[model samples]
Target: MGKASTVTSWLCCPCRCLFCGVLSCFLSVLACVLLTAGLVVLVLYLLFRPHIIHATAVSADLTNFTLTPRTWILRYNLSLALQLRNPNKRIAIHYHDVAAEAYYEGQRFAHADLPDFFQDTGESSPLNTAFLGHGSLVGGVAAAGFRREAAEGARFSIDVKLGAHMKLKLWVFRVPGPKPKIDCPLRLKRRNATAGAAGPPPEFRPTECRVWF
Candidate 1:
């Protein structure tokens, strides 16, 4: 009986040692995997920081503008150019459902839709939109304001508001977030009446605009 008890003790001790060794190896491997994953996430966050996109109204041309006093209707034809830029070095931007509007003294007159597009890292894209429509003036107050502006050098200042949904593209992952809004105000110069019968169109400069998400 003494010999049998000694043999059982020796067998159980080896079994316990083997079990402990396997558990230790598994825990070590798991810890290494977790550390590696954490490092990868940290690197990605540093490389792809959030950035604000910028837009500007680069140029505008007023071809034909007329206001009918009897009907209180304003008809205008304008060529507007825009510049969109992405400043992020490591992130691409995808824009969807972009809509733009042209306003004169808070009264909207025309609308345009921008094509959905993807902007690569550090890319600038030019967009051209046309505003050709007739809008009825609200009342005497608006008509009076318009006349005042027209008489003052015939200079017309128009405001454009842009709204779109944007997504960030990093490698194969797409991160979705809130929609982006932009407002660009443009100043159009009166045509050069002395140049010729059909004078040159109005010229505009790049107007800095801000983006909000």
Candidate 2:
């Protein structure tokens, strides 16, 4: 009985050692792979030095904003000039798609699609977008408030929202990622001092947008 038990223990000992050896080898290989991947990511980040794209609403024209309180019908013509800047010195930007919307009192009234283009490193470019024509305002309360403000012949405040999809180019390599939304709150009105003046139309002061990635 003693010899039989000794033989069984000998058999189990070798099997246990073999299983531990294989597991150790696999864990070692996995650790090495993970370390290598982390190093590669670090190197790529240092090489590209990518940065956020800055967008600013430089000017706005809202002279034709009109809203009917009875029917809640709105007729509007709004135009804006945006300044896009690539702040990265080592990377360029390739904008693939851009969309803009104008909102009054939290209600979206107009939208426009902009042409895709490329921006060089440390370059700034202006993009002009216009929202024309009109439809009924979705919210009655918002329309009434907007009408009252327009009648006051003072400033009308609205939000211009921009969304875009872009890629960063470093030399011949391209890195694609999601971009943050831009919100620019702007106030437009006839220069009360020049309201009745026989001269050019009034322009909204430049507005810096809020953005985060």
Candidate 3:
């Protein structure tokens, strides 16, 4: 009876040890899983964070610019087309408006409240005229005196200010954060006017547009 009791005691200790080992292993696995899950949540939050910003500019050819038949009205008005491009892996969600300045013959004319829209998500968009040059005089001839014939062989300079809001998705791996205001300057020569020419300006070819993120 004593021998039997000793054997039973030895067997019970081994069984308890095995049970404790299993419990310990299970607890370790649970801890690891919990840590992994926390890391995943953190990664997802970072990947999905919003409010990214960006800016860029694309200028159209000045020579291909158009003027109305009423050359008198054109002296004060100059229209230019521009393209906005997003080089990031994200979509350009919004624009903060645009500002442009034109310089001709040493006179500086500023234009604000330019129109804006989204372009191809990964490509370029149709040329858009966001600014129109105007003179102080109300459609007065020579107020700005910028007829197409007079503009021939003339040189001009442009300064552009652009603002944009961009975003990234979880699928995109690498993306840049908010960007600084984009500034661009360009020089161009006016085109010669042609008789009997109709339709949009030669440089006014429309471009396909889209946006994806």
Every model: Cα RMSD to truth: 10.8, 4.4, 15.8
lDDT of 2: 0.82
Candidate 2 displacement at residue 208 in angstroms: 0.9
What global local distance difference test value does model 1 have? 0.82
TM-score of 2: 0.78
Q: How far is candidate 2 from the true structure (C-alpha RMSD, Å)?
A: 4.4
Residue 101 of model 1 has an lDDT of: 88
In model 1, how large is the Cα lDDT of residue 148?
83
lDDT of each residue in 1-213, candidate 2, tens digit only: 999999999999999999999999999999999999999999977977767778898887765777765888778777889898889898888887788999988888899999988999999989889998887877667877886787787578888898888787778888896776888888888344435344566856777888777
For model 1, residues 118-154, the per-residue Cα lDDT tens digits are 9999999887788888888777877787788788988
- For candidate 3, the lDDT comes to 0.47
Angstrom error of the Cα, residue 24, model 3: value is: 40
Better of 2 and 3 by TM-score: 2
Query: Could you tell me how far off, in angstroms, the CA of residue 22 lies in candidate 1 after the best superposition?
Result: 39
Judge candidate 3 at residue 96 and give its lDDT. Answer: 34
TM-score of each: 0.73, 0.78, 0.39
